[model samples]
Target: FIRLMAKPEKLGDLREPRAYLTTIANGLVSDHWRRQSVEQTYLDALTLYPTEHQPSEEQRALPIELLLQLNTLLQQMKPLIRSTFLLSQLDGLTYRQIADQLHVSERTVKSYMAQAMLHCLRLKNQTDN
Candidate 1:
């Protein structure tokens, strides 16, 4: 109704008010479409912005062969123990934090970490040949 009033297309004299309303509505629709197109163009130019810790396929396999060998060697341990080791040793999370995240006691977390380290030592001995 307001759009029709603002952009009335025709004068009176029994001159089809419906035509004027249709004209205003058409113009408003066109304007709305144009705004959407322009907004889309602007957004397209904007960057998604990179993340600090982006995970990718190549990242799954590092060039550190020794680390890979050690990881493969430690595969015999329980999943929880391996995860604890990675989080605490590689990711640098504290034993307390690992315990909180894993719902285990700090002492147990420390023990798992120690076991992980010992596994790595064993791997080193096995690979030293």
Candidate 2:
């Protein structure tokens, strides 16, 4: 239990150690399955491309990992910031367009985008370290 070792505080007030460990184990299993699903979806999409256009396995790993990291980051973000970031990055929407869609001002859209970018940079730095 690397997690338990790393965060020993989690065990501080445990009335049932078995239950606590089981919960952690269950969460790890769920996370494993979720990661597998994401990887599978990526691999499946790659199959639609011609063999000649396909990436090497080495190349594919990077995007899959990045996708997983991005997924985690988005999940941790505030809902409005997440929506704003997705609209601009994934949907190729302009700030004005996103602002209109979200019923916010253009300045507010810009602020949200800035916050999202800062969050991304912070995550990147953490991973790098």
Candidate 3:
């Protein structure tokens, strides 16, 4: 409602208000669930550390927030590019290995990585400003 009020132009002709409101409400609920899941996953990972090595509550918030932002960023990427980037970064797969898995050329994997890195860099720059 705050958003609609702030940008009343988005409200359009005010026709079918119920549908518009329902769409917005559904999106909010989905976002809430995604955030909760991310937070829980972060907390679960924290449990793997010894007590003294665990981050303070204040410190933990930053990584959890970063994870949420990273999740959103990845979701915006093209599926193939996302898979290639994740394979290399998360699964420790080499470009050749990713190429074979995806049945693409190593050059293609390199291109995808470049695109992913550029996307991340652009987002970082936007946040920095």
Quality of model 3 by C-alpha lDDT: 0.94
lDDT: worst 10-residue window of model 1: 60-69
How far residue 86's Cα lies from its native spot in candidate 3, in Å, is 0.6
lDDT of 1: 0.70
Give the C-alpha lDDT of model 2: 0.92
How do the residues 1-99 of candidate 1 rate in per-residue lDDT, one tens digit apiece?
664456556233436778877887897887666556554544444335355444343653353334445545656678989999988878899999999
Clashes of each: 0, 0, 0
Q: Distance from true position, residue 65, model 2, in Å?
A: 1.6
lDDT of 3 at 1: 72
Error of 1 at 120 (Å): 0.6
RMSD of each: 24.1, 2.6, 2.2
Question: Per-residue lDDT of 1-129 in model 3, one digit per residue for the tens?
Answer: 787778889778578888888998998998899999999998998899999999999999899999999988998899999999999999999999999999999999999999999999999999999
Best first by lDDT, ranked: 3, 2, 1
Q: What is the C-alpha lDDT of each candidate?
A: 0.70, 0.92, 0.94
Residue 97 miss distance in model 2 (angstroms): 1.3
